[model samples]
Target: MPASSTDAYITDFAEFVQASPSSYHAAAEVARRLEAAGFARLDERDEWPAGGRHVVVRDGAVIAWAAPEGAGPATPYRIVGAHTDSPSFKLKPRATSSSEGLLQAGVEVYGGPLLNSWLDRELELAGRIVTDDGGEHLVRTGPMLRIPQLAIHLDREVNKGLTLDKQRHLQPIWGAGGDGEILGELAASAGVPAEHVVGHDVLVADTQAPARFGLDGALFASGRMDNLSSVYAGLMALLGAPNDAEHISVLAAFDHEELGSESRSGASGPFLDDVLVRIGAGLGAGDVERRRAFAASWVVSSDAGHAVHPNYPDRHDPANRPVLGGGPLLKLNANQRYASDAAGAGFWAAVCRQAGVPSQPFVSNNSIPCGTTIGPLTATRLGIRTVDVGVPLLSMHSARELAHVDDLAALGAAMAAFLTPEV
Candidate 1:
């Protein structure tokens, strides 16, 4: 049975937002989905297996495979990679502060969040809370805080796109007259005392779920669209792929991509290398052979690409503006920023054609410097041919983002086709 386009898009978007409060949650939900789909989980501590299955790494990354039960050696992998982290407010090491008899939680913005959009929205805290038990991982999921906006009388010039000083007025206010210990409050909810909880990586996100808008039902507004959209699409593609062993298809969802790829679970680390080595070894290849195999493989670095704004159309290239519901767009930047090349683009186009999927081209304005993703990094590190592509989105890093709901279905279908093309 096939899921309808609307059902797939809406359900996927909701699940994406729910499972992805942080990188840890994103990876956990991915692993759960893989397990539910009859994919076997591999132990990172053990040697890689010889056939197709799923492997979880670092609890911040996941690699799912679809290969024939047994195949010849030297069959290179085809990978679709995306990151799970997005721009939001992260709790500082010491998360509590008191200012003028009000309680607030200290936060440092993650990635490139639209600072102004965060004002006056109901904020929530969700992420992992580590306890002294070493394995007791608790996740808090709800609207735990709110940041009230100032009255118009207080900030009369706010309508003119005013700037916000992050350190001063951005923190959320909670429990007007409660005890000053928000940590203790949260710990009580988690069934633990504040002193028993050692550390946490808390995130503040919009509590609103994604929904359909517009008269024709073409609009989709959600959170974490910068990359989580890609993450969800990649996961669905892998899950829907045929369980054959000709060419193993893997999805690499990494964390910390928004912060320059420097973290342990980022694309710049040893996570991907270790997984490829394990996969090659599963197919009876050694380290040197694995390196050679990886070099011969290919990757589609799946991330969101910018679309031309209707009001500010001049900000985009006239010939290459990706429109809403126009299918997936191939992002290209000349300064080696996007990791796409002649070979990679040709491969992706061929795959789309074979899968009967439509695709478009995307290039930034000549006068503006373009942003980048994990595409180039992965291409350079593994020596694999890589291409960057994504659904056209609006308000990329805002508390709430927008895209075409149908575009998500198209992107997922295309990715699924790429994962499992007819032999």
Candidate 2:
């Protein structure tokens, strides 16, 4: 790829990360972009027809697909799966609290975020707010909150090793001895009355915009890179890919992967299954034909993997050391943690080669415990072949993470090829 293509892809990605402050925002942004690209937006409560590009949004999840004119019963699905949610603090029901003249916002750790990374950053509150009439509205406060860390002078041993009390120490201060209601603020942001807004799903997000920095601007830093990078790649690939492939190309961006994907919009749930079944039915598929389609289908679960850290070399596997700009990772595990088998690995290699992109393999050290993604869960749920792959990042889950500009573009290229797989 030319330097110009890499630069353009990274610039658009920075804009995407900025627009998507929460899962809800991410899903909405993707649908909006797809719509702009001439894809029709479909409502789940309504009927769907096959043979064109269409997208559907379910809460913080979105599924988009393009079926060719010749798509039919045995026309399998080529799905690129990703998640919309990231680890962050979630606002509680009673979101406002006052302590010792400092007004704070009540919160609970939503997922396993590096809690220490949440310290002393300008944060925003963003998500969907629901009205009494069951109407949902997206709301966001650009930079209204902060979780300040205890001063070194006060803690004295802060550098030795830092510890945080999730309940006690994680509340973000938004005001001091003032009559400010977090709910009211969210309601106003959404143009709804606080009394009329009965429910919310707000999350804390970093306010700092993504940037290209480091030597010769090769490195990009941003929040929510773990799965958003995959989501964006899948979206770009789907948008730019030819819709006349032999199979149905689908982008399934689910929510709540950080929480084990159990919710209705999660990968472990029926979101993807529901969409696939409906698409098959629209193509005049019987139960037996649908089964045959599943047997021929594939799911590429793309999330973020780790780049071996310079300081803690022992933490990473010795032989397989993936670097920042090397390429996307073909993640594997001895257990079914990642669901990447030899067959899946070979498929990924062929896809990368077809796209003219490089690739690498990622496996955890024998001594360390490995983490899992939506790969195993999706494969088990649908009984379809699935492979785990992703861009290598310095910080897997942090307030801010580092990635290579070229890797982001390379992942998109590889995904585009996987969607239309010539091999």
Candidate 3:
């Protein structure tokens, strides 16, 4: 509750977002933090180890846990779930093209991003690059590219409405020349030879750093905040909780949630289930014991939610408008788009009360469709009680987003309390 604590958490969160321009970088950053906190890294090929702090990374997905001392197969896990990937423009295989003497990098839109937000911004490329030797290197090119929007003189009706052609208008101009030069630049940035760079998974990102601002400097804004904020809170809560707590505290940051979570590392995949099973088996849990543990387990699917738009208040449900700095918002959708049901909602309310953290509720207007998160997919996959929650923000999937500094810290407190044993 100290001001210093909140400031520290927000500062760290901003640094995390700055370092993580892509899902791979995000996972790597999480792994780095976990290791720095004394969590050992585990390999899937090796036999599972006994009780201790450990982290496992599968591409852009990461699962970290701190097992309680003397914990067994039937011990329930207090899991905090989130995603790492954000909507951006992914560089295509043949990324080089020339348009009217401008060298542009061909790109494909990944997920539903506010395309207009990306126009006329300083952009950089970051992600993992694979060399012919099978070695993977993480590369961040800084602000080396720009997507210049058409001038108002060229499109006079831009104020009324604008339609973007993803294939035609989304290419970002990097420099003069062609593909060979761009490939060489990427290779040099990655410290590899151009010929050796066989493949890559990279995305363009805003180069501006996150900042705290407002009349009183109470708000924070940054990129990848839709879920990185949750990932950071979950990590802090798991690390802050005592290792001997009653439940095994697990932090799962998966990837590809923006694109329906169908990838192997996504929520719909077997990543969480597989890891849980391995943990149970290592604890000598039988099938029945694993089921029992799951029955007692719960998941807090944390992602960013929409704050009532000040300019378009009618878009939100009148009765369930959430505001920034109001504490974490509990997202509910009656159509199962979100996993929070009556029981889950009651349980989370109890947890918030115990943590002494204020809570808010959010439900989208029936006239508009609701967006889905990992909440429902995780619940369906694991059959665990799940509640969807997040910090309320204005820009949900823009190149840059805003969130409350106080709510960010409050989320960590709530998760820590949930991991702690009920007295």
Candidate 4:
């Protein structure tokens, strides 16, 4: 690859992170790119398009695929699955609250986030807001609502680590120092009256777009890297897939992986299975055996892996410290936190070799338990061969995260090769 190709990855990463304000936005962006490339959209509400047309499922979760104009069955569908959601603060039903005359929105921590990193940063609100005009309608207010942090003088225990009470301390103060109807203000921004706002699933997002870092500008700063990296890579792979296949190439991005994978849109739910059935039915092959064959298909469960922090080198396994720009990592754990088995890891390694990309393996120190992802759950649910792989990242759950600029391209290249591999 030329020097220009690396620049393209940084530029692409910036745009990709900005476009994905929320998981829904992330899924929508994937759908948008696939649709532009001649893929047709399918969901519970609409009939799947004819052959030569790519099929997409928009179950609030989006799964899109393209087959050759007349590709046959038994093509051994290549799959790249990722989640759209990340750990962040979610709004409560009665979100508005006030303390000491300052208006704030009550929030619940959605996942295991770095609580301290969010203490004194500029936070913004973004997500879908529901309204009842005649029935129900969706309105996306893409504005940045600032959440200012408290000053040092207020609490004398400055250096000491504080336990964050999710219910009491995590709510964000949102106004210019007074208690009032903030919902009305938000409603005005969305072009809806305050009282008409029935419900919302709002999240606090970093307003900063991803940017190049380091004196040489080798690193990149972005939000939602924990999973969005996988989302973007998978999208590129699905979009770049070739015309020949033993099975359909499916890209499924679930919405609630950060929480326990139990929600309708999470990995443990019926979303993936339902979408597979829908696609089979739309293709006029909705038999039990075909569905069984689909379940036997393979999946690449993509998510971010924690790189050994340069400043804190002892935190990683001595033999397996994945470095920046090294390559996509095959994450393994004896505890099954990650889903990679010998067969799955070997498959990914084969793809890396074919793509001419260097790869690494990561395992948490035995003293510390590793985190789980959708890899295992999806494998169990569908009995599909699944592997866990991701680019190495720093500040895993902080307000702002970092990763090498080239790794994005590396991951994308490897994924593209995997999705369109020759039979």
| TM-scores for the candidates | 0.94, 0.99, 0.98, 0.92
Global fold similarity of model 2 (TM-score): 0.99
Candidate 2 lDDT over residue span 324-413, tens digit each: 999999999999899999999999999999988999999999999999999999999998999999999997689999999989999999
For model 1, residues 168-199, the per-residue Cα lDDT tens digits are 77888865665667667657667877798888
lDDT of 4 by residue, 1-423 (tens): 345877886688678888876776777778887888878766556665544545454433677776655544333456788888888888777877767777888777878888877766666666666677642323344443444445668867865856667776677777656556655655666778878888776677777668887867888888889888998888888777766655677788888888877888788899878766655654555466555665557888889998888899988898888999888889899877888999988889888877778889989988777888899998888777889999999998887888987787788888888887753
Q: Specify the poorest-scoring 10-residue window by lDDT in model 4.
A: 135-144
lDDT of each: 0.79, 0.93, 0.90, 0.76
**Model 1: pairs clashing at backbone N, Cα or C within 3 Å:** 67-244, 67-245, 68-244, 68-245
State the weakest 10-residue window (summed lDDT) of model 1. Answer: 1-10
Model 1 segments more than 4 A misplaced: 1-3
Which structure is stronger by lDDT: 1 or 4?
1
lDDT for 105 (candidate 1): 89
Candidate 2: stretches off by over 4 Å: none
**Among all windows of ten consecutive residues in candidate 3, which has the lowest summed lDDT?**
176-185
Candidate with maximal TM-score = 2
Give stretches of model 3 more than 4 Å off: 177-180
Candidate 2, residue 15: Cα displacement in angstroms equals 0.6
